[model samples]
Target: MRILLVGAGLSGAVIARALAEAGHRATVIDARAHIAGNCHTERDAETGVLVHVYGPHIFHTDDEGVWAYVNRHARFRPYRNRVKSTAQGAVYSLPINLHTINQFFGRTMRPDEARRFIEAQADTSIADPRTFEEQALRFVGPDLYRAFFKGYTEKQWGCSPADLPASILKRLPVRFNYDDNYFFHRFQGMPEDGYTPVVASILDHPGIDVHLDTPFVSDMAARHDHVFWSGPLDGYFGYDLGRLGYRSLTFERFRATGDWQGCAVMNYGDPDVPFTRITEHKHFAPWETHEGSVLYREYSKACGADDTPYYPIRLVREKALLSQYVARAAGTGNVTFVGRLGTYRYLDMDVTIREALNAADAFLHAVQANARPPVFSADPA
Candidate 1:
């Protein structure tokens, strides 16, 4: 089988590897000159620090299979993401942990006492929280929400918290304990070299041909036995219905001597601060020693046609547009949508790989059974 795997990100790389290993020819291509997509990383020419060109992507997953799969391609160094946020002229631990709660309130309360205190501060009247604002108010109360979330959410998403969905807030965990680990996963690590090499390793097989800077077009779908698209959902259809809403990021990079910010990620929760966070590249790889450091001041904005889409704003309007695209994709033969952009959802690295693996497996299974593969092995809608 000749497979056209579009977008040389994790999704494309993983699927291409699987198909190639199964003796199928896979042609992988991306409009970008790189392979890792948003997870692309490279050593800075000046500082010799491994910089996450897009942003910080700490690989943390509970799935043993996904962990093992990545390990097979590249060596992973144990890395825990400890994020800090500056709000009201003071830095505090993220995820609203016990220490954060205590410091914000200027009192050293025990875990139980802190929990009770927050409950008291919470709005008891709002039984069913619908929006992000309501959810935060119910969980962490007004004071904490204003200090930590309100300003940050407004800057990050470029919208009022009241307009955002409650599910967005659900992604964050508020711990009553002292643990400041950003993610609660069994496996948390970073590739020793960088993500680009990891993805390159995946596409190294002889059965797979990679064409960087080559953008896949709708007309090319007819030339392949099957097409696996990992590009934007609306992009695949030429945005006939309408463009889906997405948030894009712009990085203001600067070089400095020694440590900058003294941490990998330091977010500014104050709305007054234009950029949301500052990421010190050297801090991401603590094992590597460097005299100078590189930092990126990240600013989030509404995604434009030319801009790279980061997070999908799946509000009611975007969801309706996505549904139209999903329907059109279903009717289109010899093509299957995969990955975050195709699904119009914010997915972790592990989930993306897991789903890509499944999609490839399903395609192989369909071949064995002499049946036509479904438009989506894992439904994007």
Candidate 2:
């Protein structure tokens, strides 16, 4: 079987490797000059620090199989993502931990005390919170919401928290204890060398052929027995139903002599600060030491035609547009829309890999059973 993978990112690479191992010829193509998609990493020419070309991507997952899969390909150094925020003229721990709660209000309250204090401030009137603002006010009250989440949310999504869905705010946890780690995953780490090498290794099979800087055309689909589309969902359909909204990111790079922020990610919670967060790349790989440092000030904006899409803006408008695309994809044949862009959902690296693996398994099972492969391996809705 000849398989065509539209994008040479994690989804494409993982599925390509799986299919190739099962005696199928896999051809992976990407419009970009390099593989690994947005997670592509390269060493800074001047500073010698390995930089995340797009942005900081810390690999963390609770799935044991996914963890083992990445570990087999590349040496993963244990890296915990401890995020910080600067708001109201002071630096504080992220996720609104006990320390952050105490510092922000100038009170040294214990865990139970802090919990009760926040509870008293919380709005009990909002019975069923629908929007981001209501959810924040219900949980942490107005003052903390204004200081930490309100400004940051406005800048990140390019809309008031009042307009955004409450689910967005629910994704982030508010800790009563002093746990500042961004994620609560059982396993967390970064590739020892970089993500590109890890992906390169996955696509290194004899049955696989990779072509960089090659965009997939409608004509290309006919050449393959099956197609795994990891590119944008609307892109697969030529956006006939209208473009889905997405928030694109632009990084402003700068080099420094020593440690810049003494941490990997320092977010600016103030809306006045144009950029959302500043990431120090050197801190990502703590095992390796470098005299010089490299950092990026990440700015989020509405995605344009030419801009690289980072975060999907799945508001009311985008959801309606996405459903149309999903229908179009279903009617189309011989192609399985895979990965974040294909499904039009923001996915973690682990979730992306897990889905890729599952998609490959489903395809193989379908082939064995002499049945038609699914149009989508995962539900876009």
Q: Tens-digit lDDT track for model 1 on 1-381? A: 899999999999999999999999999989998899999999899889999999989999999999999999999999989999988999999888999999999899999999999999999888999999999999999999998899999999999999998989998999999999999999999999989999999999999999999987777888899999899888888887889999999999999998778889898999999999999988889999999999999999999989999999988898887788888887887888899988888899999999999999999999999988867657655
Error of 1 at 159 (Å): 1.0
> Candidate 1 at residue 292, lDDT?
96
User: Which candidate comes out best when scored by lDDT?
Assistant: 2
Residue runs of model 1 more than 4 Å from their true location after superposition: none
Q: How many residue pairs clash in each candidate at the backbone level?
A: 0, 0
Per-residue lDDT for 28 in model 1? 93
Residues 1-381 of candidate 2 have per-residue lDDT tens digits of 999999999999999999999999999999999999999999999999999999989999999999999999999999889999999899999888999999989999999999999999999899999999999999999999998898999899999999998988888898999999999999999999999999999999999999998998889999999999998999988877889899999899999999889999999999899999999999999999999999999999999999999889888899999988988887988999999999989899999999999999999999999998988869998
Report the error of model 2 at residue 307, Å.
Answer: 0.6
The superposed Cα distance between candidate 2 and the true structure at residue 259, in angstroms, equals: 1.2
User: How does each model score on lDDT?
Assistant: 0.92, 0.94
TM-score of 2: 0.99
Question: Among all windows of ten consecutive residues in candidate 2, which has the lowest summed lDDT?
Answer: 235-244
